[model samples]
Target: MWFERPPGVPDWSEAESYLRRADPALGAVIDRVGPCTLAPRRDYFVVLCKAIFTQQISTAVATTLFGRFRDLFPNRRPTPARVIEVLGRADPAVLRGCGLSRQKTSYLADLAQHLADGRIPTRRLAGMDDEAVIEALVGVRGIGRWTAEMFLIFTLNRPDVFPVGDLGVVDGLRDVFNLPARPTPAEALALGERWRPYRSIATWYLWRRGSVPVAAPAVPVPDAVAGAPPCARRRRPRPAAAPGAAISPARPRAQK
Candidate 1:
């Protein structure tokens, strides 16, 4: 249950009522989970970079790496300038020492460049529609459809943006619909239609019911790299708690 909701988060009361009326299956999920506690955050620059850091790595590696990355900037703040400066170095050891791969470092460079050059209108994202926000974000290196969707749900707190591609959502469908196996993306999208306009919240409950797949990169990747392919993930997808804390790859504010 939410002890406190930050400013402007839509009331879950209305969503809960509608979902309960619309689908009893999801209502069961909501009842068991208690309440939606998705606390969206600001600091778009930092969040975007966090998403990049999580690419193609496990949560433990991502967490430690992002912490070291914070050390690169003054006062442990990762401004665009700081990222640009550190990544600009000729030697690879600069970021590699933090366990970042060349691909991830390059992705971070692209993101920092976009922000520093005013490519992404971060301040205006709240006003943009879901598609518009996805468009703006995907233009940056490493930010893809899936990454944008997570950003929508977790960062902007959008009400409807269902991520059919997410393995966790599909796995949850297996439990909710009692399917023999995880639904295909197309199958998942079609099934998700029942929850329309509140799929994001419905998905939160689904995540509570199923496994949140380990961190996959923004770019296309094999299931092995992401830890589990869709068909096999249900066998042992990490608990939802892992993704809740590590999906973004951002460190705590108090990290010194």
Candidate 2:
């Protein structure tokens, strides 16, 4: 598991049982994928910053870069103030030396600034609902809806989120239903409502659905069923998906 399971997260045992009952196809996936492993870190700033470092990079590469990133601060913790101080420097060579791309550096700076200025008040997130948390996270420069949704699921452990634009979700859903083409965002949204408040758990299983044979998927896999892991279907990210934008909570309901 990338993160250690925090004590406050949902009851894995109960969630699995509920999900198994709510979504049978997903239940098969859960049986194949094994236990839910969503252990979230408590530090909001660090999670978002590391998310920036991880953008568009391989896992080994991201690991190396994050290690170098940790070297910049004492006790290996890049607190908001410490990161802000580093970004504020005229040269900022120390930060760039971590092998982060220029765009990623800018992203880190923006996130740190958000935390420092209270644009993203980490302390208040626990009290905020899912949409509110997404809004606050996407307000930071260089972050978009995909990142915010991931933060909601993986970091905050919000159980109901359904990231329709995520390739894993799309691919997983496609395979589960044996669809001829990938479902659009709106289509996925409609299909997902059956899972309701447990959609996040359903999503976790869907992410790994590609790796397992669907319990009762029909014969002859479609072109759309090509194996793939769930990531932002827009792997890097897409624009914000919020109420004010020309978008829904999922990706803008794109035309097929």
Candidate 3:
């Protein structure tokens, strides 16, 4: 059997150098997070199937459901024939209970049909560019830019993909840049240009930074005010105020 790495994959140092010059904020994050490597998969079908299983669900939950799906077909990785045999007459409710949304169920079924009909041409995807891969995969019901980008990253191991549509990337940018609001997809795409040719590595750092807890900002207490009377300390409010009472009003009443 022949084996090959996917196209557009850059060496780690090359990707890291590009990211380091792209943005200081992201460069710091990359330093902290270190290198990330894509998980290996034997073929496009397994990755696409996992992508279908993962939509709109937590990673843990997706793993559980995928485990069950895999258990249902122990002889081999899920093929269209095997999937149809297990899911064709199965209740939609049962599938939903397995954690698949209604739309995802439809998407999976459609994907299986396409695979069976030879419409997807999975082998051809490896040789295609990012845009071509997206165009091919998006024809399926549930696959969008994010999903296609995931396939490109994990399955094809493409080094330059940036999933600007991902909420994680948006949150990462907000945290790293201290932005007042999360960046929109267009904004992220525009901002990501500097990382070009290695956006995927930059994205991995962003994802890692987003997952780590940020330290709270240190607050400073003011030094004693000049000309303040020693008795001024006695004027402080007591902590025994009623639960509904205002703790600090905008204006204090004049002393009687």
Candidate 4:
């Protein structure tokens, strides 16, 4: 009778037991991965803005850019109003100096306006369901289904979201399930349904599966998976198929 609970919900032991009963395949992953204790971000605006900067880039580059973007505010949290003001006064090149492309700058500007004007209702998102948040956020120029879904998982802490477009998630599912090939977006969604009501928690474990330990020395990445979004498929090689050892090499893609 155990089932996976949302972020604010307690009784993880019961939820884990429920998930084990619901899908033994995922249960195996749970056993291997151990518990999920992901901390959700409270700042929706900053997260979405950072998602734009992270698209199609390496993590080091994203880190650098994110730091620079934050420095524009200099010890502040970079609210939407301040972002819009800075964007208005600063040169496009100035914003680009933070590693944003011209397109992303435009997207960021649009996103700031939406939040500033109450179009996105960023403050009210906590009360909305996943789909409602997605619909509301996607109306902004740069935000898409994938970005909205990430916001749900990382920002809102919604437990049921399944970001099938994410290369890491797709590859993680393939390796965990021992599929013949990587699943298409549709197929990934279908497979993720089995982890219902706590797919976000499941996703954290999947990412962990493919993730190299923080202290592990860097290893050469293998060739990218075909059809994966640019810069999102470079993965550390998995050791020859052993149970609990199959890791996806795919990186997180910042889908626009």
lDDT of each: 0.71, 0.70, 0.62, 0.69
**Candidate 4 global lDDT:** 0.69
Residue 41 displacement in candidate 1 (angstroms): 0.7
Q: Please provide the root mean square deviation of candidate 2 (C-alpha atoms, Å).
A: 10.0
lDDT of 2 by residue, 87-167 (tens): 677365766678666777777888888888998988899789999998898887677788888889888888899988787
lDDT of 3: 0.62
Q: Candidate 1's error at 91, in angstroms?
A: 4.6
Off by over 4 Å in 1: 1-10, 210-256
Rate residue 209 of model 1 by lDDT: 55
Best model per lDDT: 1
Instruction: Rank the candidate models, highest lDDT first.
Output: 1, 2, 4, 3
Estimate, for each residue in 204-238, the C-alpha lDDT of model 4 and write its tens digit. Answer: 77776632221111221222333444332433434
**What TM-score would each prediction reach against the true structure?**
0.78, 0.78, 0.71, 0.76
How well is each residue in 100-199 modelled by candidate 1, as lDDT tens digits? Answer: 7888788888988888887788778889999999988889877888888888999999999888777678767766654546777766776677678898
From the highest TM-score down, the ranking of the candidates is 2, 1, 4, 3
Task: Write one digit per residue (lDDT tens) for candidate 3, span 1-256.
Answer: 1124245434476677677676766666556555554543556766777777776565678788887667667664788777767677777777776677766677778888877787777767778899988877888787776777777876777889988767777666556544446666666675567678888777776766643433221211112311233311222221222322211111111111
Model 4: runs farther than 4 Å from truth? 1-11, 211-256
Pairing residues by index, what is the TM-score of model 4?
A: 0.76
